[model samples]
Target: MDQAIQGKIEEALKGLFTAVSMLQDAYPGKPFTPDGRLVGDIGEVVASLAYELTLNEGLTKHHDAVTDDGRNVQIKTTFGTSLTFPVHHVPDYYLGIRMNRDGSFEEIYNGPGHLIQAQLSGRKATKTGLHGGLMAMLKRINQQVPDSERIPKR
Candidate 1:
């Protein structure tokens, strides 16, 4: 089920990336790249029976999509099932896409901030230490750049 959900999320992100890429291509030097960074969920659930059952449960996933050009996207997914009782609920899948300088790609689910940062930095996170390194890099970037400049100043 996880694999299937991952596939669906990936597909959705690809479509979004393509549209964004087109806009970037149409306007060169406008600071556009498929490798751009984004955070947060594209969608959120206002009300859910699952929350009622799980005692106000909430979830968010970042980096749900990436373009072939190295753009990164965050996605939030919600699962809805036609059945109730016995607690049968579909899982909401979040995807984070990272493109390597070597042209490789990695998609992560339910990742931490450091892990996502590593991906954005063209590093593959295979160990806990690597995650720490990624976090450090992210901290540095955050400190160096103002919030307004972080995302195209718009």
Candidate 2:
């Protein structure tokens, strides 16, 4: 990475850490681990910005985003791991995103909910057990999407 770009990324991460720390301080009882829910939220935010999708912050059935074309998108993100099956609700499409340790996107999978569910149905829920199969499916799906549909890496 360029020195300037690296510096910018470091600055952004500091800001995110400060924000999360403030939230933790405000709500003492909540579980806000950096590696858990925080990363997931960051992933969602990144996806929303990348795809220009509208996020549903309130309680919703299944989908997290609504596209301009009226598609309901459910985004599931993991850190180089497989997403668990039997999500609370099913959406029109399932978007599986894998993030790097630094919270940058590594890969993305977009496909029908049923197809993704079927592919992951019989797998063990643990990260170690599900990673291989999930990655394979994600790679296949990733290839299907046009470059226009994907977010450009900065």
Candidate 3:
């Protein structure tokens, strides 16, 4: 990356981290979990910007965003190994994103909801049970799509 571009990326990341920290302090008792929903929100923002999708705000029944081609996408984020999907309400597509500790994406997986559900049908719904098989499924799905449709590790 160009030095100037790298500098700008660092500045933006610093701002994001500062804002998350402030929110954590302001809402200390809120149930935002380990990082106060910072990681998940950042992952959504990254996916929205990268994939050029409109993010759905407020309460939604299933999906997080709609693609330019009108596909309903459910976005899920994890630090390294875990991914959670709603068993009953599946979207048209599921976007599994893994983020680094610094909030940058480590990998991205886009696949149909049915395929993912099939893979997890008789398995435990935990990180240890789901990580390997889900990752393999993502890899196969990624291979079937164009480069623009997938985000590989950096």
Please tell me which predicted candidate would have the highest TM-score against the true structure: 3
lDDT of each: 0.32, 0.63, 0.64
Please give the distance, in angstroms, between residue 123's alpha carbon in candidate 2 and its true position after superposition.
6.1
- Per-residue lDDT over 1-154 for candidate 2, one digit per residue giving the tens place of the 0 to 100 score: 3456445655776776677788899998984545656666766776776664677886466677877666787777875456543433345766778765454566557756666666566655663333343667667767876665543333
What value does the lDDT take at residue 60 in candidate 2?
A: 68
lDDT of 2 at 18: 77
Runs with alpha carbons beyond 4 Å of true place in candidate 1: 32-38, 42-154
**RMSD (Cα, Å) of model 2:** 7.3
What lDDT is obtained when candidate 3 is compared to the true structure? 0.64
Model 1 lDDT, full chain set: 0.32
| Span of 10 residues, lowest total lDDT, candidate 2 | 124-133
- Candidate no. 3 TM-score: 0.62
lDDT of 3 by residue, 15-115 (tens): 76677678889998763344426556666777776665778886476788888767788878876566666655556877888765454564556757776
* Candidate 1: worst-modelled 10 consecutive residues by lDDT: 80-89
The TM-score between candidate 2 and the true structure equals: 0.60
Error of 1 at 63 (Å): 18
